[model samples]
Target chain A: MQDNYQQKILGIIGGGQLGRMVIQSAINYNIDIHILDPDENAPCRHICHDFSHGKLTDYDTVYAFGKGCDVITIEIENVNTEALEQLAKEGKKVFPQPEIIRLIQDKREQKQFYKENNIPTADFILTDSKADVLANADFLPAVNKLGKEGYDGRGVQVLKSEEDLDKAFEAPGLLEKLIDFDKEIAVIVSRNEHGELVAFPPVECAFHPTANLVEFLFAPAQISDEIGEEAIKVAKDVIIKLDMIGILAVEMFVTKSGEILVNEIAPRPHNSGHHTIEANFTSQFEQHLRAVMGMPLGNTGLRMPAAMVNLLGEDGFTGDAVVEGMDEAMKEKGIFIHLYGKKITKPFRKMGHVTILEENVEALKAKALKVKDSIKIKA
Target chain B: MQDNYQQKILGIIGGGQLGRMVIQSAINYNIDIHILDPDENAPCRHICHDFSHGKLTDYDTVYAFGKGCDVITIEIENVNTEALEQLAKEGKKVFPQPEIIRLIQDKREQKQFYKENNIPTADFILTDSKADVLANADFLPAVNKLGKEGYDGRGVQVLKSEEDLDKAFEAPGLLEKLIDFDKEIAVIVSRNEHGELVAFPPVECAFHPTANLVEFLFAPAQISDEIGEEAIKVAKDVIIKLDMIGILAVEMFVTKSGEILVNEIAPRPHNSGHHTIEANFTSQFEQHLRAVMGMPLGNTGLRMPAAMVNLLGEDGFTGDAVVEGMDEAMKEKGIFIHLYGKKITKPFRKMGHVTILEENVEALKAKALKVKDSIKIKA
Candidate 1:
C-alpha cells in the first residue's frame, strides 16, 4: 500500500483524451501521473506530472516508463504486452495484466476466449490463414476482422458476395456472420485487485456509418430494464472471465430477437462512458483510477439522464484545429463541451465531445442533436 | 472575442485549491492557465500551463504575471488589486475587476457598499480608531471585525462589555450588533461580462467553534423553500450590486426569527459550493471559468443531495500530511474524497474535503458523521 500520497505515482500507456481525463482525476487525489506517448503534443502533456515521448509498442520504451511507477495501466490496448509481462513478472502491478491485453488485442483470440468461457458473443470462426476463409463458401455475407491491428474501421470489412471476398489477405483473421441488431450498447465495469467490482449503467451508442466512430451516446439507454440488465450481466461476466482489474468497457449488440451479443471490450476508460463525468455520481475516469490504485470503487449511479455528442474534425479542413459555433452551442442549457488539446485536425479525427443532460432522455437527445449540428471542428 | 482556443490564456492570481480546480475545468476548454503563487509546490503547479513563484501581494509580481495573459482572474482575494487595475487599464480582461476587489478587501467598505446599494446585511458602524468603539459603549455585546487581513476567524472578536473591548485594535474596522442566528448558509452566484447571472442552490455550513472553520456543508440548505429563496435573493442582489464577474460566494446568517443577513462574500470559487462539483450539473469551478471567459453559464441545477466534510490537518501533527482511515471511509457508498497537495500538515490547515450524496439528507448527514469519525488527517 502507498504510505504517502506523493509517492503514489501512476504510469499510463496512452496520452489521448482517456489519459488526459485520468490525469485530471489523479490530480484530485494528489497522485503523480506520468504518460508515455510518441506524440510530444499528446493531449495529456500539459496535465500529467511527467511525459516520456516514446512509442507505446516499443519494448524498451514501455519497460523504462513502467520502472519508476508504482502501478502501470493503459488507456489503449495496442501496447507492448511483452514489456508489461516482464514488468508483472518482476512484481510490478500491471492492471488487466499483460495476458488479458494479449487476449483482447486479437479478434480471433478474443472470440475464442468468449466461446471457451461460455460467454455469449457473436458466433465466429478463427482461421490461421485467410485463404481458408476465401476458399470455403460457408462464411459468406460476413464481417471480416484482421486478427491484429484492426482499429475502428480500418481493418474490418463487410463481405457480402464472392466478389467482395478479395478484401481478405493472407493473414490470420476471424469471420463472423452479421446479425440484424436493434441497437448497440456498452457497459463500463471496473474491478480492483481485491475483486470488488462495479458497473456503470449501460449506455446506447450510435456510430457514423462511414467513419465507424461513435457519433453520440445516451446514458441509461432508452431500453427496457430487462435489456439493460442483460447487457450489464454480459459485461460483468466478461470482466470476471478475464479477471480484469481496471475499467473494462463491454460493447454489445442487442439483436432484434431480444438476445445480447458481446461485440468487443476495451480494457480502459471508453468513449461510451464519457457522459458519466457530468451525469453520474462517479466519473469513469475517477473510478478507473480508484480501481487501479486498489482503492474502493466509487458508487456507479446515474444522477440524471444524459447524451454525449462527438466533435469530429471536418472533412475539408486540416491544419491547426478550430472549434466553430461553440458560443452558439453554449446558449443551450445543460450542454458541457470538452475540446481535446490536439494541435492538428484531420478528417474524422476526434477533437472533442459535448455532454447534454436533462430529466427526459428525449429532450436530452433533441438538445444533443442541436449541439451536434451547431458545433464543427475545423482548421 | 478570442478566435482560437490556443490564444485564450487565462492568468490566475492564487495557486490554491480553487485555482487547481479551475485549471481542471479549463483543460476541457483547451485554455492555457498560468498561476502565480509564492510556493513552488502550489497545488496548481502540476496541471497549469505555466507557473511563476512570487508573492501575490506584490504589485510588480502580479503585474508581471498578468502581462502576457489575455485575461486575469483570482482564486483568492488577497492579491494586489493595483496590479489588476493596471492590467485592466492596459486592455486585459480582469474578471471581478480590480475595483471590486478593492471594495471587498476591507470590511468597512464592503458593509458601506452594501448599505449604499440597499443590499441586506447585518447593521454595522464603521470606525477609524479602536477608541471610538470603546467610546460608544451601547455597541456592547457586538462583533468587531478588523477592516483588512481578517481571515476566517483570526481578526474577529465578540465583546460583551467594556472589559472585553480591549481586544479591539487600532485599525480601520467595523462593529456590528450581534444577532441570534439559527444557521449559517451560503449561495454561490456567477455572472458573465454580458450581465448574465446564475446561482447554485443555497448550502448550510456547520463551523468548528474554536477554529472558526467549516466542519461540513449541506447542499440545498435543509431549510424551508421560502428561506432558501430569500438566501438566494440576497446572494443575487449582492452579486449584481458588486457588478461581479466570475463567481461570488455570499455567506449569510439566518436569524432565529427567519431573517437573512449577508455576513461576507468571496469573489471566487469557494468551499461552500464544493459539493456542487459532484451534486450539480455545473461545478462552481467550471462555472467560474465559463463566466470569466464570456461563455454562457451552464445549468445550475441539483443532480442530488450532497454534504461536504472538510479534512483539516490534525492538531499537533505538523510534518508531511498523512491521511488515515481512508480505506475505512471508502467502504461507504457515495462518499468522495479530495486531498489538496499540501506537503505539510499544520494544525487546522484546510487540507481537503469529502463529498457525500444520498437521497435522504438525514441519512447523508449520518454517513457524513461516520466518515468524519473514521478519517483523520495527520503527519
Candidate 2:
C-alpha cells in the first residue's frame, strides 16, 4: 500500500502501443518508465526512460529486468509468469499478478477461470487438436480459438459447418458456442490494491465482418441505459473476482434475451477504451498506471460521446509506412488521431486510431466513418 | 498551408517546462520534436526526438538545428532571431515568425508595437536608462521594466516614490503609468497560417506578493459575461494585430473603471493557462502544436470550472527536489498535480502546478487553497 513506486522506475514487459500509451501518461506524473520487448524497433522504445530488447518470455531476461525495478507491469500477457512470480516473491510489485496473467494467457484456462469464478461466459469445450473438435460435433457453428499466443483477431475462427471445421488448424484449441447476441460491448475497469474500483462507460464495439477486428467503438453505447448498467455490473463482477490490480477490460455480449455474457478479458489497457484518452475525465492508460502504482483511481466519467476507429494497414502494404489523407482527416474538429510509432506497415496491422467526439451520437457516428474512409495506412 | 510537419521534425528552442509540455502533446500527433537548450538536463531533453545541448542565442547553433527540421517553433522568445530569419529565407517554416519575435523581445519595442497597432495598453514612455526615468519624473508611481532578457517576474519593479526609484537597476527600461486594476486576466489565442483563430476563456490570475509571479489562476475569470467577452475580444484583437502563428497569451488588466487594458503578452503557452490541461476540451500545449503544424484548431470550451496554483520552489531549499504531501493532495478527487522534472529546486523557481476542478466554483476555490496548503516543493 505504500507509494514505493512514486517517481521511481517502473518496468513494463511489452513495448507495443499499450506500453507507449502508458508511458505517455506516466511522464505527466514524473514517473520513470522502462520497457522490455523482444524487438529493438518496439513502438515504445522512443518515449520510455529505458528500453531493453529481450524476449519477455525468456526467464533469465525477465527476472534480471525485474530485479532492477520497484514495480513491474505488462502491456502483453505472454511474459514469463515464473519470473514474475519470482519477482513478486522478491518484493517487486507485479500488477494483475503473475498468477492471473498465467490463467489469462491460455484460452482454455481463461475460460475455466470464468467458470470457476461463477462468471457468465459462453459454453466452451477445451480440446487438444482440430481432430478432437471435429469428433465432437455437438458444438458446431462455434468459434475455434488457440490456447495461447493469439491476439488482434488472430488464432480465432468461426466454424459454421463441417467445411469450417476442416479449415481449423492442428493445434490445441477451445470450441466456444457462438451466442446469438444483440450487441458486443466492452467495459474497462480499474482497481488498486486498496480495493478501489472504477468502471468506464460501457462501449459498443462493431467488428469488421470478415476480420473479426473491432471496426469502430462508441462510448455510452447506443444501447439503453439499463443495458449499459447491466454490462458494467457484469464487468465489475469479473474484475472483483479476478482481484487484479490494474486495468481489466471485459468484452461482453448482450444476447437477444438481454443476458450479458463475458466474451473475454484483457488485463491491461484494451482497444475498446482507446476513446477514453480524449472523451473521459481520465484516460485508461493513466488509470492503469494509477492502479498499479497504488495511487488514487481517477474519475471515470465521460466528458462527451466519442466514436473510435482503428487504422489497420491496407491489405497490400508491407514495408515503410505512409498514412495518406491525414491532412484531410485532421481538418475535422474534435477529431484526435494517435499514430503508434511503428515504422513498417504490414497488412492488417494496427498502425494508429482516430477518435471523434461530439455531443450528438448520430453526428459522431457519421464522422467516425468518414474518418475511417479518408485515411489509409500503406507502404 | 499543408501539414508538412506531420510526422516530421519540429525544432524547439529552450527545453524548459513549456517545451516539455509541448512535447507531451506533440507525441500524440506522431510529430518528431528536437530541442536545443543549454541545459542537457532540461525537462524536454529526454522526451524529444533529438536534443542538442547548445546556446539558443548562438546564430550558428540555432541555424544548424533549424536546417534539420521542417518547422521551428519556440518555447522561449530569446532565441537568435537572425538565425530564424535566415532559416525562413531558406524555406523552413518558423512559427511566430522571427520578425515578430524581434519586435516583442524588447519591452520598449513591444509597447511601441501596441501603440502603433492601436492596441489598448497602458500609456508608457521608453527610457534609455533608469536615470532618464528619474530625470523626467512624469511617470512617477509607475512600473519600470527592462527592455530585454527578463522573464518570470524578473526585471520589473514598481516605482511608487523617489525612494523606490533608487531600488531600480540601471538599464534601458520602459516607464508605464501604473493603473489601479480590479483583476489581472489572461487569454490564450491560437492562430494558424490559414488565419483560423481560437481563444480560451479569460482566466483571472493572482500574483504572489513577493515573487510577483502568478500564484493561482481561475478559469472563466469570476466576472460578468460582458467583462469576460470584452477581455477575450481584446485578446483576439492583439493576436490579430501580431498576426503570429502558434499560441499568444495576452495578459490584461480589468481596471476599477471597468475598462480592460492589455498588460503584456507572451508568444508561447503561458502559466495562467496551465489549468486548461485538465479543465478544457483541448489543452493550450496541444493547441500551440496544432497552429504551428497547420492543422485545424480545436475547441477551446471549458470542461469544468477549475482553479490552478503554481508550485514555486520553497524559499530556502536549493538542492535536489522533493514534493511533499503529494499523496495527501492526490487523495482529493479532481486534484491533478504536475511536477516539472526539475532535479534542483531553487527559491521562487517554477517547479510545477496543481489544477483543482469542480462544478461548484466555491467548493473548487476552497479545494484549490487546501491543495496549495498541502503540497510543498523542497530540496
Candidate 3:
C-alpha cells in the first residue's frame, strides 16, 4: 500500500502462525506492516497492511520486499540471510540482525559461536557423515541432529546404539551426548534496540513422551524460585550476546542437581511463552511488538497462575481436523482455547492449544490435561 | 479444502475487527470457522479455516458462503437474512436466527419488537423515510436514525430543531426523543443455542464529544451496585426476549433519576465491552467463542480496574495512518494498545484503541485520558 507519506512500515518475512501472531503485536503498536511469504493464504496475510506472496529464501524476492519497509524481521529462521545482510548494509533495520542470523542458521557455526562465547551447551562433535560419529563407537549414545529445520522432534534421532546411525537420513549433522535432566525449562526474554532487556518468569515445559511436542507448560516453573531465576539469567545472557532486538526463547535442560544448560535458541516468540496470552500482565505477543518497535518493554509479571496444554492432532485421524470433547472441556472453568485455524490436521500436527488460568495452579494443571486428552483432532 | 467432515462449521459474515475478534472466540471451542466479507484482506482472513470474499447483502454470495457451514452467525447485522432464512429451512443453524435478525435490522421493526415484548426503550417514532420523519415536526429534540448499516455512532443523528431536522441527512430514519441521561452504560451477555444466559457487569462509556465515537469505557459502571444489578436484569430480559444465541451487547442510557432505558442492540461483540480484553476474567472474545461452540462460559470476574480508549483517525489525516505518542505512552506503565491494521485513515475512522489496567481506578482514569489525548492518528 503506497502512500505519498512515509510511514515506518515493518516488513516481516514468513507469514505462518508466528507471523500472524507477530503482526498482531505490530498492529497493537500501530506499526505499518508489509509481509512476504510464499503462501497466498499465509496466516498473517489479512492482518498486514500490505502482503506479497514470494519466496523468503529467494534473494531478489526478499530484497525487493525488504526494501519497501523501514525494518525487516522474521517469524522463521530459514530465510535468505544474504539478502537480509545486503539490506542491513543499505541501512534497513534487519533484526536478529543479519549477522546474528548468519551465526544461528547453520548448526556447525552456531555450535562454534556457543563455544567461542563461553555459552553452556551439550558437548557435540560436528561431522561430515553419520559414519564418522558411528566409527567413534563410544559416542554412539549421543543424539544425532541436523540443526537446520529441526523442530517438534523432526531432524533429530537418538543414537542409542551404533546401528541407529546406519539408518540416518543425513550426513552432516551434530552428535551430542544426550544429557539426563530432571526437567526441561525455557525462558523467553526481550531486548530492545536501546539495549534495555526484560525477561518473563521461566516456564517449565513437559514434552509428550512420544511426540516430543510440548504437551503442557507452566509459568514461574514449578521448581525452586532460584532455578527459575537462573534460567532467566541464562536467557538474558544469550539475548545480550546476540544483541537481539526482539524476543528470544532459550530452551534449556535442568540437571538433576539443578544446573542449567542451554539446549537451543529460537529468535522469535517461542511456543514456551504461549501461556502469556492469558496469564501475564503484558503478553509475550504484545511484548515482542514493544521490543522490535523500540517502545518500552511491558511488565512481564504473571497476572494469574496458568497452565497451557497443547491441542495436537489425535493419532490416526488425518483427513480433516475435529476436536471432540471440546463440549465437555469448555465446561471446565477458566480455560482459554487458541486454535490455529488449520483446516487439516495430520497425526500429531499442531492444531491449537488450550490455556487454563486460575489462582490455583495445581487445580488448573489437572483440568488442563483433561482438556488436552478430551479434545481430539480427528476426522 | 473439501473433505467428508460431519462436524459443524459456523459461518460468520463480516470480517471487520469485530469479526476478527469473534474468530478468536470460535477458535477457543475448537469450532470450525468460515468468514464472508467483501474485502479479501479483512482482519480475520488468515485466522478462519476458509474465507469467501463477497458483499454480505448479496443473496448468491451469502447463500453460497453459507452452503457448507453447518450453522451461520453474523458478526455484523448488515447481511442477507432472507438467504440465511432459506438456508435455515434446509436445516442450517443460524444463531439469533434469521427471524431475530430481520426484526432487528430495521429501526421501525426493532422498536416494534421492544414494545411488543415490553422491553423499555427511548420514546421513538419510526419514519417511512426522510420525508416521513420531517413531516412530523411535532417531535423536536429527537434522535434521528436510519435503521440499518449504522454502526459506531453512524446511522443516528440528533434532531433538536427545524434547522437540525432540515440539515440532517435525509433517508429512511427514526425520530426518537432525546433523554436527560446521567451516564451511558452497556451490558454484554452471552447465550447458548439452549437459551442459557450470562451477563457481564454493565460498563460505563464516555463518548468523544465531536465524533460521537466511544472515547472511553469503564466496567462495573459508576452506578450504585443496586442499579448495576438492575442493569444486568434489564439486559437479561432483552436477551431472553430476543432469544439471542452467541454474544449480544445491549447498550443503554442511565437517566437523571436513575432510570435505565435500552439504547440499541449489537448481536456480536461491542466496542463498549473492549475492557473485557484486559479487565475481565474471560474476555468477551473468549466468551463469544464459548457461547457459539457450546462450551461452558468462563468466570466473568474483573481482574483489575480497567478503561478502554478508542484510537480514532485524526481529522485531515488521509491516505496513510500513523500513531503518535506511543513511545512516550509506553514509558508509562499499565497501558495496552490495540491497533487495527487499516491501510488508510479517514477522519473518525476507528484506527485502534488502548486498554489501561491499573489497580487504582482514579489514578488509572486520569492516566487513561492523558494517554488518549497524547495519541495522534495522522499520516
The per-model DockQ list reads 0.51, 0.45, 0.32
| Chain B vs. true chain B: TM-score per candidate | 0.96, 0.98, 0.93
Candidate 2 docks at the CAPRI level of: acceptable
- TM-score of chain B taken alone, candidate 1: 0.96
Location of the lowest summed lDDT over 10 successive residues in candidate 3 chain A = A1-10
Using all chains and alpha carbons, the TM-scores for the candidates as numbered come to: 0.96, 0.96, 0.85
Query: Least accurate stretch of 10 residues (summed lDDT) in model 2 chain A?
Result: A1-10
Question: Which regions of candidate 1 are displaced past 4 Å?
Answer: A1-6, A127-130, B1-6
Candidate 3 reference-contact recovery: 0.44
Q: Better model by DockQ, 1 or 2?
A: 1
Pitting candidate 2 against candidate 3, the one with the higher TM-score is 2
What TM-score does structure 1 among the candidates reach? 0.96
Stretches off by above 4 angstroms in model 2 are: A1-5, A224-227, B1-4, B224-226
Per-model RMSD to reference: 2.0, 2.1, 4.6
Candidate 3, residues B1-379, lDDT tens digits: the string is 2212235687888877777766555544445678998987676665667889999999999999989888777878888999999998998878767888887788778887888988889998878677787788888788888877776778878888888776554776678888879999999998986656888888899888877888988866889987898889989998888877878888899999988889888777789888787788788877876676555677677887888988899888897676677766666566777766576789999887888888887988898889888987888
Q: Model 3, A93-188: lDDT tens per residue? A: 888788777667777777777787888888888866756776665876777878676767787777888667675546577888788889899889
Backbone clash count for every predicted candidate, in the order shown = 0, 0, 1
lDDT of 1 by residue, B1-379 (tens): 3336456899999999889988888888999999999999999888998999999999999999999799899987788999999999999999989999888888889999988998878888887778978876697788888899887577888877889888886788989888778999999999998889988989999998788888989987878999999888999989887878889999999999899999999999998988887788789998998899887788888878999999988889999888888876666667888888888889999888999989898899898898888788888
Superposition error at B66 for model 3 (Å): 5.2
